[model samples]
Target: MDRVWEAELRLPTPLVELRDPLFGTCRVLLKRDDLIHPDVPGNKWRKLKYLVRDARDRGADTLLTFGGARSNHVRAVAALGERLGFRTVGVIRGEERPTNPGLRRAQERGMTLHYLDRATYRRKSDPDVLAALHDRFGGAYVVPEGGTTPLAFPGLAELVNEFDRPYDAVVCAVGTGGTLAGIAAALPAGRRAIGISVLRGAWSLDAEVAALHRSVLGHPLDNWTIDHRFHCGGFARRDARLDTFLARFGDRHGWAPDPVYVGKALLGLSVLTGAGEFDGETVVAIVSGPGAG
Candidate 1:
């Protein structure tokens, strides 16, 4: 079995137009990675690519990964694995609830879901926990939560090639910081890369971002930075205004915005663009996943 399943997709051309006149100052283009794969979509699909390959190369029949109560990564990976005939397992953080929709969906998709207490889940980054999972799962390949690794970044870097016009800035939401890191590494010099934080108490993501640059790009990013002001009380936080914005934007552009990634990215982009952050230049915001459709 091939580790990485190449998702069939039509990579979008340059300059995604904004239907909102409010964002007219700067031209916004979207690398429609959302269209990358039907099942495993967008940056998640790319990040999972080499990891899946590595898993297969290691002779693993099962794929194990970690995620939150409502992780897009979980949704994508479970569906991808089931479609590809690999037994899938999701080590989900937080208590298993009778009403968790994402978990239910994952289970319905045939993924073995393991619910872990927050204390144990918090230690997911530690090698000991990973080793334990490996031991229990009998050598199942473990992909770090969100598949954020050096291998993942290189695939995301290829997104830079799809844009024709030189961009003044590129913005994306940071979860594990993989997507932004890859884009920053691949973007041309003088272009600014801004990461909008999505995880609360995620102060250490900058180090992850920097490390990705060094490892994937073979250099360091001194100019790129992150904005943590509007994580909106952490991941999965909701506001009526965000819903309205997402609905309106999607209606105009015929795109869907999932609450986790693209929703926050659009939220930050709205604020930053309104603040004249892109007043004198063109900006490209990576639309990481497909809209509600």
Candidate 2:
């Protein structure tokens, strides 16, 4: 429990006030999870909170996790590890790049960086990769990519504590389904939870959400749902429309969105609402990260 805890932060990015004449009427409210920390920001920080505490409790001197070369999770974990007095090791996908920003930041923050090919990185979710990592790191505590695990759920469940209003629905961009699952578990009787997946073919998100629910609450949640059509060409891919939206969003709200995560999610919500999916309900959209612009 002696590990560093990033403060719980919130910001109001204009709610459903912007209207698209062709689309329909909808309000856009942003939950600024990105501003939760200066370096290890947003939902990433929330998910890692319990993990960091557990690492300290177990007397772990080093933290090991896996992600892509430019993963926001890796960058945030590196920053958090440095602040929390823990050495970090990130098993990154793709060939090693001497000029990778995430890698350079990790190195600057004293994190040991490990590179693996895409095929090998694909094995990261397997227990074998974890075992191999443990052998190499020698007692480094392992955190899953995206800091996902049962423990991470409760921190997100606590998000309901931050809101004082009655939101008809809670929405967020789903990467691994942790945040969406957490919200479903934390749902008050009448509220709906919606997840906009950033990955294509995210049909698996439902199963993942169910697993998280079972792991955290010891039961599957029956309430929440996912809308998978808005991935916008999957992670890191963007177009002019999204770019214009991001620019306008920043100009209007004074917040930045990384094209990979929040931008896609935000754009997805707009598309969904414009299609009359969110017709007449008050919704809270969780802006999970300010990972990159």
Candidate 3:
């Protein structure tokens, strides 16, 4: 929400070395996007810049958005709204259980939390459902779940500036496809954007991202593909292997991965590079985890 964003708003995210599994032959690097900001860090910050601008430009005083109970998007929107002078509302999916840290932070940031059952949450964008929210909130601007709207790309595309040169390929964990879409939107020539699905199910991520790209750029972009190998058995579903990998990764690299997004993408990077997937000298994984991890 700073006036500086009115310009190009190019960020300088750190790119750190993750591992040299092939004795420095096949090197893997981590794009430390999580360090981009404190309250609204990583991909969350990248996805919201233009969205916040759009809300303000429309003369909207209240910003309404959707996410899960523990969604980073919800917390980021709440924090940004509070700091930027916009009233925020969060449409949380699933029933509210006991105290959740993310939701608590959103509440502390003054976001009005509305809990919806799974069924209703799935239909959040339906006309009837949206109409209900409009009637109740009196015309607050709605940011889709995961902030994956057309407005998200401009901010996300700016993230491309963080990389001076393209690696063999750039990878990001996909939630609602906004992060991936933005990366693919500004994909430099000769570089590929790899979308690693962090959530399971039959939802066609390619189809969704294609639709989003078309809406924003007038056509779908090439040089991007989806990798379904890294969900770790669906969103938020952790097991012994994932836990062990996360622990070992943090212990070795000294950077703890957010169990939700960056951890899964890191696991995928290990798999792809170990199998000798790409022919480039360097591969980059956009790590939205804390600091170096």
Q: Which of the numbered candidates is closest to the native, going by highest TM-score?
A: 3
Q: lDDT per residue, candidate 2, 247-284, as tens digits?
A: 97778767657777777777777777777877776677
By TM-score, how accurate is candidate 2? 0.88
Off by over 4 Å in 3: 3-10, 22-24, 95-98, 289-293
Model 2: runs farther than 4 Å from truth?
Answer: 1-25, 96-98, 251-256
The models' CA-based lDDT, in order, is 0.77, 0.76, 0.79
Give per-residue lDDT, candidate 3, residue 202: 36
Q: Mind giving the per-residue lDDT tens digits that candidate 1 earns over 109-221? A: 89988877889899987889887887877777778888888878657766777787777888888888888888888778788889888778798989889877887667788
Model 3, global lDDT: 0.79
lDDT of 3 by residue, 1-293 (tens): 56643232225778877664532355677788887767778887888888888999999999999876767788889988988899999988877543487788889999998877889888998999999999988899998887888887787777777776547778788877888888888887888888878888636888999998888889989878888877878888776767888888777768668877888777777777667676446777897644211
The superposed Cα distance between candidate 2 and the true structure at residue 286, in angstroms, equals: 1.1
- Overall local distance difference test of candidate 2: 0.76
What's each prediction's TM-score? Answer: 0.87, 0.88, 0.91
Best by lDDT: 3
Instruction: Report the Cα lDDT for residue 119, model 1.
Output: 93
